[model samples]
Target: MAALLAAALAVTGCTAAEPGAAPRAEDARPTVISVTDGDVDLAILGEVYARVLTSGGYDVQLEIHSAQDPVSSADRLLAGEADFIVGCTGELLADFNPAGAEEIIDQWPELEEEGVGGFVVYDELIASLPSRLSATDPSSATSCDDAAEEQGLTQQVVPIFGATLFDREQREALTGITRLITTADLEDMEEAAEETGSVVEAVDEWVLDNEARSGGAFEDDREDVSYLYTP
Candidate 1:
């Protein structure tokens, strides 16, 4: 995971501006922008806003929070800890009462309209010798090698797969797969990787259709997926 994360940061070249630089009082800086910690989905949106804000001469401070708990985030805002909080519009509507906050900027309509959330993949690899087998779910009780042994599939299949931002957890739940190959993974792959969206949608549809063949159940809770976006 660390390696993948490092690769992602390297690929995106995400960085903050230099510290100790005094903000120009007349520069129309954004002052601050609060965000949930390590949200790959939100990061995509945040990066877009960050670039625009910077170009507009705003000295943006990206605040990483533990979660998008509105009450907590609003407390920070009320305390003057943050000038703006970037999160799901649903969360902002619920947590930040428009009557209470001085202003609100809803970005959900823009995000959804633009299809901002990119595709993600969870790659599962074998970590043993002979390396003759690899499967999505290691805990499947039925091993890939066992199936291969039964069917005489000697060639090792890398099991390259992908999923959308929403279905990632569902795919993980079915296969007991822990590691995920996010947009960051493709960014890291450089010449070897293609756009994650195309791969994820195709693989996600394939997984849905081949559930019986894969011996995996589709028990993804839609509510959990919703929480990824909602505060």
Candidate 2:
């Protein structure tokens, strides 16, 4: 993993196109975004973002590793090897602020009874992020919410990014993607991937289905779908 990250950093900004060749469509792209990969669900989410961002005119690259561990992936994102990652609220809170995880989880049920809701954890996560990083508004969908109910954590899926890397338009586009996802949608995507034997193929099918269901809500053209988000 160390060697791979070093190699990625060594050539972070270098492009491979020949100088004399006529400008290709890729040449005009404004940003080349690097995204990290992890377990099956995270990998699916990464590809989903890649497709959405590509349609918005940015070049997206996925960094696949031999092993997919969430903590290591989060560390890589903090070190700036990649621009973005799909994370969860409770899980990331544990990763970034270990000592507080149990206390926060303990306090959650009472907060819910009093009507504070899941934002208790989400707000804590926002406060815990470093100055160099920012996270999108979390999706209602969580990779672990039901399965890990015993753990008393609300693992809301969220897109985390390097703050300095994206402009306002890019950030809003990503936030839009976050809002459109749901837990049921994620489960269906995973099932589709299992049947298709390819994450990309499954995500493509899911995108088409979503577009049709919402009257083309997930259109590729940025101008066609206007997403109004604050961050």
Determine the backbone clash count of candidate 2: 0
Q: What tens-digit string does per-residue lDDT give for candidate 2 at 1-231?
A: 222211222212322222354433433333333333434677678777665654544455665543434435567777655556776788778777776777877787787788664687788888888977787788888885432465577788888876655444445545656777888888898898889898777877788877534322244543322221111
Q: For candidate 1, what is the lDDT?
A: 0.31
Model 1 Cα shift for residue 144 (angstroms)? 35
lDDT per residue as tens, model 1, 4-73: 2212212111122223434333234334555554333333323333332333333555555665454454
* Stretches of candidate 2 exceeding 4 Å from the true structure: 1-38, 66-71, 145-150, 212-231
Best by TM-score: 2
Give the TM-score comparing model 2 with the true structure, all chains together: 0.72
- For each of the candidates, give the backbone clash count: 0, 0
Model 2 Cα RMSD, 1 decimal = 11.3
- The TM-score obtained by model 1 is 0.29
